[model samples]
Target: MLIRYSKILLTAALGALILLVAINNVTDYATNYQFVSHVMSMDQVPTGSPLEWRAVTSVTLHRLFYAFIIAVEFSAAALVLAGAWRLLLRRKAEAARFNAAKDVAIAGLALAVGLYLFGFMAVGGEWFQMWRSLPDAEQAAFRFIGCAALVMLFLGQRDD
Candidate 1:
């Protein structure tokens, strides 16, 4: 039984880590969109050139996609943590409901966001064939959301 909890907790920890990474990217985007876009334009960066990860290059960061990504990531992290908290406390009934709801958000909204970004990366990203190939900040926000989802899933599975 203890081993089971440990396993679940371990899973949660990994998931949280991924989610945190995604969140960090979201922060970077929120904080640096304008700067990045300016840099991109200043550099006269060709669309086919690799994206400068550390360098603010894309003015497009101010787009709706960026905002949507941030919101979805936030939701994933928030709901995942909330559900995990309930489960950790051994509130099985509540945990189940909360976790279920969170799972829906993560799988639905999170999934959509991820897919959209992936496509954007492929399309405007020019198949990542650009010279620098950096994604401005590499989107740590998605990692954070993924991590949070993992943790919540673990909690939901816990026998406690």
Candidate 2:
């Protein structure tokens, strides 16, 4: 029971963190937008690199990409928070019931992991060569993915 509560709380916490990130991005749109633009432009990558051709130089595309990121963040947060709520409502139920309520949370965490691991790291870091930039976000994405993955593992355990 205590462990179930812990899992619910951790899921909520992660959801809150993601919500905050989305809010920050919306509230400070220009600042974060610049980061996205820079990464997409790949201007910071070594000038002569062969991968430079992969850069997305269009301003419209940068805005679209940033918008997609915000949308995913919001969706993940909503799902995780809703899952936590469902868990809280069923906290006193049987283990099977509680376990059944974890699906939404698991989906949310998976989205978060996918966002950071595939969206940011694989696409931005490797494809766009964001790692070569001064203000790279690959480390941040790694940390986020790690935390989300750990929580997903913990939450997946049976509540017996």
Candidate 3:
């Protein structure tokens, strides 16, 4: 039971973290948008190189990408919160039933992985070469990915 509650709490905590991050993105839009713009535009990276062509300088596209990122984060937050609620409701059920309640949380965590892995690492890091940028944006993405992945591993453990 203790382990079950711990899982529930951790899941809820992950939901809260994602929710806060989404809220921050919405409330403090320009900050992360700058990160996105810089990464996508590749302006911070040294000019004159074969990779220069990969930069996406269109303002419209920058806003679209930022919006897409926020949307995914918000969705993940909602899913995880719902998953936490489901777990709370089923905390006392048989182990199998309680385990079944984890699906939404898993989905939410997977979305987080996708955001950091696909959006940040693949698109920004490799495609746009955000890692090569002056500020090195890859670190932040790696941190977020690590946190999400760790929580996901913990959430995947079966309750005895």
Candidate 4:
């Protein structure tokens, strides 16, 4: 029971954190947008590098990318929070039932991991050489990925 409660609380906490992040991204659009824009533009990458061709210089694409990221964040937050609610309601149910309720939370965490790992790290960090110009962005994405992945693993465990 204590373990169940801890799982539920951790899920809720992660959901809240993601929710806050989505809100922050929406409320402070330009700030995050700039980060995306810079990463996509690859202006921070060393000039004349072999991979310079990978830079996306289009502002339209930048906006689109940023919009997509924000949308994913909102969706993940919703799923995670909803899953947490389901877990709370089923906290006292049999282990199988409680475990079944974890599906939604797992989906949310997977989405978050994909976004940070593939979206930021693979596309922006490696493809765009963001590490050269914006190592902090890569680090931030790593942190998010790590947190979400940890919660996912914890939630995947059977209650029994």
What's each prediction's TM-score? 0.44, 0.97, 0.94, 0.98
Per-residue lDDT of candidate 3, residues 23-87 (tens digit)? 99999999999988988888866767888888888999999999999999999999989999999
Q: Supply candidate 2's per-residue lDDT for 118.
A: 90
Query: How do the candidates rank by TM-score, highest first?
Result: 4, 2, 3, 1
Residue 132 Cα positional deviation in candidate 1, in Å, after optimal superposition: 3.2
lDDT of 1 at 139: 46
RMSD of each: 6.8, 1.0, 1.3, 0.7
Stretches of candidate 3 off by over 4 Å are: 134-136
Per-model C-alpha lDDT, please? 0.45, 0.92, 0.88, 0.92
- lDDT against true structure, model 1: 0.45
User: Can you write out model 2's per-residue Cα lDDT over 1-160, one digit (the tens) per residue?
Assistant: 7798899899999999999999999999999999999989999877788888999999999999999999999999999999999999999999999999999999999998999999899899888888887434888898899999999999999888
After superposition, the stretches of candidate 1 with alpha carbons farther than 4 Å from their true spots are 7-31, 34-61, 90-160
Model 4 steric clash pairs:
none
Identify the runs in model 2 with alpha carbons over 4 angstroms from their true place. none
Give the range where candidate 3 is weakest over 10 consecutive residues by summed lDDT: 131-140
**Could you give the candidate ranking by lDDT, starting with the highest?**
4, 2, 3, 1
lDDT of 4 at 160: 86
Between 2 and 3, whose lDDT is larger? Answer: 2
Q: On residues 36-143, what C-alpha lDDT tens digit does candidate 1 reach at each position?
A: 344333344555445534343344544654565556556554554544453355533444443444344334334534533553344334433222334543344345
Total clashing pairs for each candidate: 31, 0, 0, 0
